[model samples]
Target: MSLKVECQKEELAEALQLASTASRSNSPKFALKSLRLGAESGLITVLGCDGEMWVERDLACEVIESGGVLVDAKFITSLVSAMPSGQVALELLVEDGMRVQQGSAEYKVLSSDPQDFPEPPDFGGEGELTLKFSQLQDALDSVLYAVTTDPHRAILTGVQVSYDGATLKLVATDTHRLAVRTIAQEGMGSSLSVVIPDRALRAIRSLPVGADDDVTIRFGMGRLGVEAGGARVVAQMLSGAYPNWERVVPSEFSRTWQVERDQLIDSLKRAMIIASESANRVKFSGSGDSLVLTAKSEELGEAKEEIPMIADNGQIEVAFNGRYVLDCIQQIRGPGIRFELTESTRPGVIRPAEDGDDYFCVIMPMSLT
Candidate 1:
């Protein structure tokens, strides 16, 4: 069909950008690299999909003809972003081409039949969960970094979402480390859980929804759907059993060291300078009223820094991946951090000095040698 519409350049660009998240520019199939734009009732909806994931956004526009067209996602997004200014008009100038015009500049881009694009499945009706967009974003930030990048372990590449009556928890683990964040959600006593890919959560976090906007979440046909403002993000859910993160989290620790978050972060960064040359292993040992961070590299020399901390159970020595510890502390918003450990070999637990039991990270230890 043909789509004739005029919308602000910024809005068009943003819509295309959202859709481009799922569009595969390098895909061999043209439809997988293309996004469809439909004009109807003073609105232009842009949709893009790569078979598994899809993103759709609606923009208020002047619709002259009710129709649809498919165009290259990357080219269209960049083209609209570079438009001179103000409004950009889109219409079928040829049998198989789209004309984009802004000010005196104009370009006719090749278009494909909208029918060639796979339409996203319909996801409507009341959702199982509803929460503020900011709440979901905050929870996502705390755990996404821990999600595994390994494609082979599809389950570990996703965040485990579980809700039970009063609280919603998000858990992620890459086998080396685990991150968990819980939020207070009133009502809804039923318990449910789902594993959503990290990529999909990242796309949802990128949506330009208001901080106070309400986001609706729905699931169907083994797919998870998130909707907020005029945008919708949907993706296929991962299969197989997720690791029991609860088991990885230490139930009790014999020693706990309370230290300043910023100070430890700085110390780790400096130690990593040398530690990076040695598999990022940084030794943590007791030193009176403070803790010493030491990393030695035959080629890069050694780094040693001491930070004030109170450790219980006399003396403790442990070695961990410096980068892994840094990742956990960066997610801590509080000024203080607590490191809980039973021994050098067991996985150490880290939690913010504040927030009670709301957030924590469990990191596997490295060999001290």
Candidate 2:
């Protein structure tokens, strides 16, 4: 079928930007097969991707003819992005090829058989949950950093999502540390757990924000799909059992300290500057209402910074990888945070002081010896 379309150049460029980040394959064949087309509400939608992730953008069509086709993603995006700002004509040429013409420049893109491309999984069943865009983005941003990169431990490679009628929790861990963030929601279903790949969560967070519209997440069988802002994301769930994170967190602590978020972050950043050179270790000596951060390297001189803190109970000293602490604090947004500790060797619990029945993070300490 033949069709002509004209739309904003910036819109096409933005679509290409999103698709480019998710396309990591080397072979142009698999990368090009990621484009998809669908018709709805009198608009022609074009989607591009690299199989695991997909992005869809709609352009107004004259509807001289109505059908769907798939073309090489790289060629089409490169051509469209470089085209001059103005109306561009896209037509279906003979022998399964696409013709794009603008001004004096014209390019033909050969398309593959659309029938052979992989289709996104259809999430069946009426079961679904809704979450505000702000809340969902926060949860993803906070916990996704801790997801494991080890492919052999597949379960840790994804964020574990669990929902019970009243609250939804997102947890990620890499054995050494864990991040858990929970947000309150209404109309949730039975308690369900799904391991969503870190890549998929990041893609969802990239959606345009400030829209009051709620994102709908549908889960069934072995897949989870999210629909937000006229776009949809379908991702396969990681097949395995996530570690028992709750058991690893300490139930009781002997010492608790309250510290200013910015102060702690700044201290960690300075400590990491030196610790990063040496095995990335930073020592924390807790006593009374003060904490000392120290780092040393055999080749470089040692550095220490003392920050005032609000501590209860007795004294305890702990050592941790400075990079991990910085990563955890970067996710936390607030004026102050609370840290609970049982001993120098135990995992430390850090949470926002405001306390909204939200989530908390646990960071394991490194052995000093």
Model 1 compared with the native: what TM-score?
Answer: 0.90
Candidate with top TM-score is 1
In the range 267-358, model 2's lDDT, one tens digit per residue, is 88987888989878898888778888899988777889888888887488788888888888777787777888888788988887667247
True-structure Cα RMSD, model 1: 2.5
Q: For model 2, what is the error of residue 84's alpha carbon versus the real structure, in angstroms, after optimal superposition? A: 8.6
Q: What is the C-alpha lDDT of each candidate?
A: 0.88, 0.74
Query: Can you tell me which runs of candidate 1 are displaced by over 4 Å?
Result: 64-66, 82-85, 103-108, 123-127, 188-190, 296-300
- For model 2, the superposed segments whose C-alpha errors exceed 4 Å read 1-4, 19-24, 27-33, 37-44, 48-55, 59-111
Task: Give the per-residue lDDT of model 1 (tens digit) for 1-369.
Answer: 777888988888989998899989999999999999888999999999999899999989999998988899999999998876698899986574999988888888998889998877765433366778888788899999999999888899999988887899999999999999998877633466889988788889988899998776787678888877788898988888888778778888888788999999999999999999999999999867899999999997999999999778738899999998998899898999988899899999999977749999999999999
